[model samples]
Structure formats: structure tokens, C-alpha cells
Target: MAALGMADRPITVGAVCVYHEMVSTAVEALKGSHIPVAAVSTGFPAGLSPFHLRLAEIHESVAAGASEIDIVISRRHVLTSNWQALYEEVKAFREACGDAHLKAILATGELGSATKIAKASMVAMMAGADFIKTSTGMEKINATQPTSLIMMRAIRDYYERTGYKIGYKPAGGISTAKDAVQYLVLVKEELGRDWLEPTLFRFGASRLLTDIERQLEHFVTGRYSAAHRHPMG
Candidate 1:
């Protein structure tokens, strides 16, 4: 893979978070690869399913060899200010994920406010989220600087207060090389380089790999490729 080949330099590819059904296949394919499997569970994107079904989705993903589980916290309940329900929902999903790392997707676009974003991040971390993710990559307006700042600040404060190093992941619509670099820069500036590693920081992107490859080619070669030119995965 081009990204894997680039690991000798400044950047490296992290885990590839996919859907529940794709976990087993991806895990087998990436067994000897550098990328880990991070599967989205708990009825991702919409997340309108019943609680039990969502929990089962998470459990199944972990059992299917996913090393990490990205579960969407109930935004409807969170927006309604049903703090207890939101807390319980995340707690339940954390239990279902077993030892698989849990990344709670706040889907920041739907939360609609920085204040709400901060509160939701706190709730997710307290509810046992290994990482508080920014978005689901389905919203037209996904990860923004304000929401990401709020979440990262919350993680820093929570670490000071509780000694837990909850991670931060900014997902959705983050498909450009410059955007990824800027996001990493923001994290380094705000949360420090201690949080710069893939464990504490991740950009949940679909087309990010291709974008990175283009940047690599532009650096190695003298020109950018045509839109149809794709690097081998």
C-alpha cells in the first residue's frame, strides 16, 4: 500500500474503521498489515435503532475481530437533554464492546452547539468511551474546529480531573491532505503532541487515503495526477 510504504517518513496509516459486516473480512485481509480494524456499530449514521439491537451490533463487531468499536451515542436523547438516558446508552454499549476499544460518535453536526458538544463529550468519557469521536461522516456539516476544540479541551480537563486519557477523533467530510494536516496541527497546538499518536488522535475519513497518496505523489513526482489516477491500496 502507498500509505504503508510512506510510514518510513513523517506519517503512518492508522486503523481502518469500517461497518459491522465488513469487520471480519477486513480483519482477515489486514491481518499482517499495519492497519487495525475499527468497526462502526450501534446502528451508525442514523442510530435510530432500539437499544438491544444496537448493543448486539457492537458485540457482534468485536466478536468478528474488530479491535475497536465506533458506536454512535443517541443524539436524539442527547439533544433532548436526557442526560441520564444518554449516559446509560453509552454505558451499555461500552459493556457490549467488551475489551474492544470504544469510540463514541457524538455526531457533532446534530448536537448544534458548543455547550452541548462539551457536555456530550464529558458524558461519553464518563460512560467509559475510550475516545469521543466528533462525527459520523454522514452529515453534510461534520467535524468543525469549534466542536473539535470543545471535545479536546474536555478531554484535557477530564484527564486532569480523573487521570483518564480519553482520545479524540474527528470524523466526516475531512478528505483533503491540507485539512488532515491542519487537524493534526490543531490537536498538537491545543492538546499537545502527547495526543498526536494514532491511539489518542484519529481522522475518521473515507477518501483520506487517496488524498494522502496524491500528496505523496506530488512530493515525489513533480506534478499531481489526474483525478482518475489512484494509488494501489
Candidate 2:
């Protein structure tokens, strides 16, 4: 927080994401900074908790002041080709958000195939996910180029069919500035400039920020600093 506050130029992340228990603490720390506090709810990376418990978790997180909620979807719904069940589940999660932007984490790495990933992305948007995220950063594969491409195409197709712009987030494994730029380029080529804004696009790579700071420092000083020089906290 101090590092963010002391940056030479204006630089703020899309939001500070934390587990539900830390929502209030993040909210308190980011007070007056205009950065929304985002919480990972609905059993997070697993999403295997009881259905009612998942919905209740979302409600609790929002009530605790999380303006954004990242909820994981049940991979079983996709694996079993139960699109209706997946849609209904995401819809319930969205409703529970109560005006908080809902980011649906597909956990693409676990979905088994490109076809399933595409189908899951479409279902998530259809159910009112403000964004369709690529991974939970805990999956075995995390975010890969092919998975991201599939999700982006799904986003493009959904936008064409419904005329509603849904955001995209490629989380996990994107830790370098080069990798970050590659995703940015992919989004621009696949989704166009409109999705480039922070409101419509975000990288779930916290370590990317550190590398960015390092690059910026090198650009300004003609010397590359150690990674420890830039701390996320």
C-alpha cells in the first residue's frame, strides 16, 4: 500500500483481491484511494462447498464491502455437459453479488479440453459474469496461450450475439512484462480496443506488477534493479 501510494506517477491496480475474511481490512487500507476491494468467494479455487454455503459466502463478502467478487464455477458442471446447471449456478452467484461486479473463474486448466473451456466461457457470460477469468492460479496448468485464446474467442462470440461487452482476465503464470504484453496484444487483436480499458480487462498477475516496476526503474536509471527492490505489499 505504501509503495502504491509513493509511486512517482499515478499508478493503481484494478483492485486489491483477497479472501472474504480480509475484505474489511483491505477496504480499510484502501480507503479514499478509489481502488475497489475484490474478494474471492464461493469456495474460491475449489468451488466444491455446499451450494447454499457458496451463495452465502458471496453475500457475506459483499456485505463486508467487497465491490468485486471472483467466484469459481464447478468444473463438474462443464465436464458433465450440464450447461443449464452451470448457467444457473453462475446466475445465483451473480445475484448474490448484489451490484458487486462478478468475475467467474473457469479454472480452465481443469476443464479438460478447448471445447469445454469455450462452452464454459459462454455459459458464464450468459449467466451475467462481468468477467470470465482464465484460472484460479492454483490449477496444474494455470494460464496458457491456447486456453486464453479459446476464452477470448468465446468472449468475442458472446459479445457479437448479445451486444454486451464482458471483460476478460487471464490469471496464473503471467509473471513477466513480456508475457503481460503478449496477453494485452492478444486481447487487442481478439476483443478490440474497447476491452483494453482497466474496466474491461485485467491481468490476475500480481508478480507482473513487480516486473513492470523493475522495468520502469531500469528505463529511468539505465540500471536494472533486483526484484526485491519492488515489493507488492
Candidate 3:
């Protein structure tokens, strides 16, 4: 993903996410590169594991040297309208995160309504989530522009009330330069340019890097190239 002059230029993705076992390797691989290794934790993509086990997984991932933790929230809590449970669970994850940034994945596609998405976003942020994410990419629907709009509005409301600028990530199904630009435009028009930076905004899909490389190649050579022309770093 960094083959596109990411080491020399400021075009790198904010972080590279991987499973817990790979955290140490990714940390060492990215040492001194200023790129954080994100570990997916809390029984990611499903989050149905025992509560203590889930928290223990977070500790393990952090112990393995993950600079950021992308955790999945218990969908049952949100589905049952249990705000207090969700808040406490997310807060526990934040505490377990230690110095690592905590991103709460709402799995918005599994969520039934936009209001639920907004509320989940607020509850996660209130519990000290460093970023509120849209999905795990395992859901049937993920990272739609409409869902992103609701999440961004929630972020705006949270910032206005609490003075904390939480980040946003729309994962899944984003694979082209045009798709990325649309998201950028959405964030700019909704949350302003401040949210455009890596600190506050990130695309969670990896295929996007390949497509972006292709677009840049076309821009430079004035012609489209085959998919194999670009190799991910």
C-alpha cells in the first residue's frame, strides 16, 4: 500500500490494520515510519465472544504493540436499545486500549436505522472512542454515503457539545479514486476541511490503494495501465 512514494511523500495511509498475531510484525515493519499498526480486537467482525475474553483480547493486542485498536461493539446492546451497556462496554475497551487509539466499529450495515447509527456513534465517543467507524466490512451493506452522512452529523454534534474532535472511518466497498474523492467531498461539505486529514478521516478499504495507484499512473503517463502494473508495498 505504500509503494506509491508513501515513504518519501505524505501520501501514506494513516495506518495498516491486521489481526492480533501480526501486530508485533507490523509494528517492527513500520518502525520509524510514523505509521501506526492497527490491530482488530474485541472479537472483531462478530463481537459475540465472552465479555472478559473480548477485553483480554484488547490487552493482548496492545501488549503485542498495536498503536491503534479497532474494536467491534456488541451489536446486541444497540439492537436492544441498551445505551448504558454500550457506554460501559466501550468505556471498558477504552481503558483496555491504554495509550493506543480506540476506534469503535458500529457495523452500521447491521444496524437497522439511521437514528440508531447516530446514537451508537455518540455513545461510543462519549465513552472515549478516539474514532467512530462505520463497519467491519463483513456486513452485507457497508460504508454507504447516506450512512456516512448520519455518522458525520453525529460527530459534529459530539464535537460541538464535548469539544473533542473524534475521527471518522468509512470502511468496506470503497475501491476507486472516484469513491475516495466522493467521501472526501462529503467530509469537507459536512464536517469542513479539518476532517480531511488522516488524523480525522481514513478509508478502511485496502483495494482503494491499488485503484488510486492506477489513477495516478494514468495521470502521469496519460494512459490507463493494466491492474498488474502496480504492486502494493
Candidate 4:
């Protein structure tokens, strides 16, 4: 919190993400700040919980003061080509979120193919996802360039058709300053400058921040700081 509350220029994260158990604590700690508390709901990392329980979890998280909910989509729905099921599931999750924004985690690695990833992205957006995320950061093959390209193109297609902009979040494995910059450039090239803001794009890798801070420090002082110097919350 001290790092984010820098007196010279506060560098708040996009959001403080936590499980439902810590939503209240995150909300309290970030009180008076613009950062929203995001809770990972819907069975998280793996969306295999009972259907009703998943929806109930979303409601509970929002009631706990989470302004954003990151819900994992059922990979099985995509794997089996059950687009209707995927759409309905995400739509219900969106409705459960009420006013809170919903970020749908695709778990792309488990989906098996680039085609499935793109299809899942479209269905999630169609079902009213505020953001289509790449992964839960727990998959063995989380966040790769090819998968990101597919999802970005899906977002582009959705925008061209519906004229509604949806956000994109690439989580997992993006832990370096170079990786972060590359993703930023990719977003700019694919989605244009409009998606560059925090409202439309976000990196789910917390470790990436440390590298970014180190790079900034190096640029300013011409010296590299130890990794331990930049602590993550």
C-alpha cells in the first residue's frame, strides 16, 4: 500500500485482486483510493463447481464490496463446442455481477486449440463480459503470444460487429518489462490506442510490476536495483 500511496505520484495498481475471503480487507485497505477490489469467483482457476454455487459466489463477492469479479469460464463448454452453454453460463455470471464489472477467464491453455480460444472469447463477450481475460495464471501453458493474438482478433471482430468495446486482460507468464511492453504494443497494433487505458486493458501479472519499477529506476538513475528492492503487495 505504501508503494501505491507514493506522495509524489501515487502508482496504484489496476485493482487489488483477492479471493472472496479477503475482499473486505482489500476494500478497507484501499479505502479512499480509486483502486477497486477484484475478487476471483466462480470456482476460480478451475470452474468446475456446481452451477448454483458459482453464481452464489459472485453475489457474495459483490456484496462483500468487490467492484470487479474475475470469473473463470467452463473450459469444457469451449472444448465440447457448446457455445450456447458457455454463453448462458457467462450471461448468468454477468447478471450476478449486477453493477460490478465481470472479467471472464478463458483458461486458454486448457481449451486445446487457437480456434477454440477465439470462439470462447466471442461467446464470453456476447454474453456481456466487461473483459475477456487470457488465463487464471495457474494453467501450465498460460498466456502465450499465439493465444493472445487469437483473443485480440476476436475482440476486434466483436467490436466491428456490435460496436461495443470490450476489455482484454492477459494474465500469467507475463513477468518481465520486455513482455509487458510487447503486450502493450500488441494491444495498440490490434485494438488501436483506445484499448491502451486501464479501463480497456490490464496485465494480470503482479510480478511484472516489480520489473517495470526496476526498469524505470534504471532509466532514471542508470543503475539496476535488486529484485528485492521492489516489493509486491
lDDT of each: 0.86, 0.92, 0.92, 0.93
lDDT over C-alpha atoms for residue 169 of model 1? 91
* Candidate 3: stretches off by over 4 Å: 1-8
Which candidate do you rate higher for TM-score, 1 or 4? 4
What digit string (tens of lDDT, one per residue) describes model 4 on residues 33-106?
98999999999979889999999999999999999999999888888999999999999999999999999999
lDDT of 3 by residue, 180-222 (tens): 9999999999999899998999999988888887888777678
- In model 2, the runs with Cα more than 4 Å from the true position are 1-9
**lDDT string, candidate 1, 1-233, tens digits:** 35347555744567877888889999998887767799988888888888789988987888899989989887887789888899998999888988989999998898868889899999999999999998888887899887888999999999999988999999888889999888888899988988998889888886887888788778877678765678533
RMSD of each: 2.6, 2.8, 2.5, 2.7
Candidate 2's residue-wise lDDT over 125-189, tens digit each? 99999999999999888988889899899889988998999999999999989898899999899
- Better candidate by lDDT, 2 or 4: 4
Using all chains and alpha carbons, the TM-scores for the candidates as numbered come to: 0.92, 0.95, 0.95, 0.95
Runs in model 4 lying further than 4 Å from the true structure: 1-10
lDDT score, candidate 4, position 152: 93
Q: What is the lDDT of candidate 1?
A: 0.86
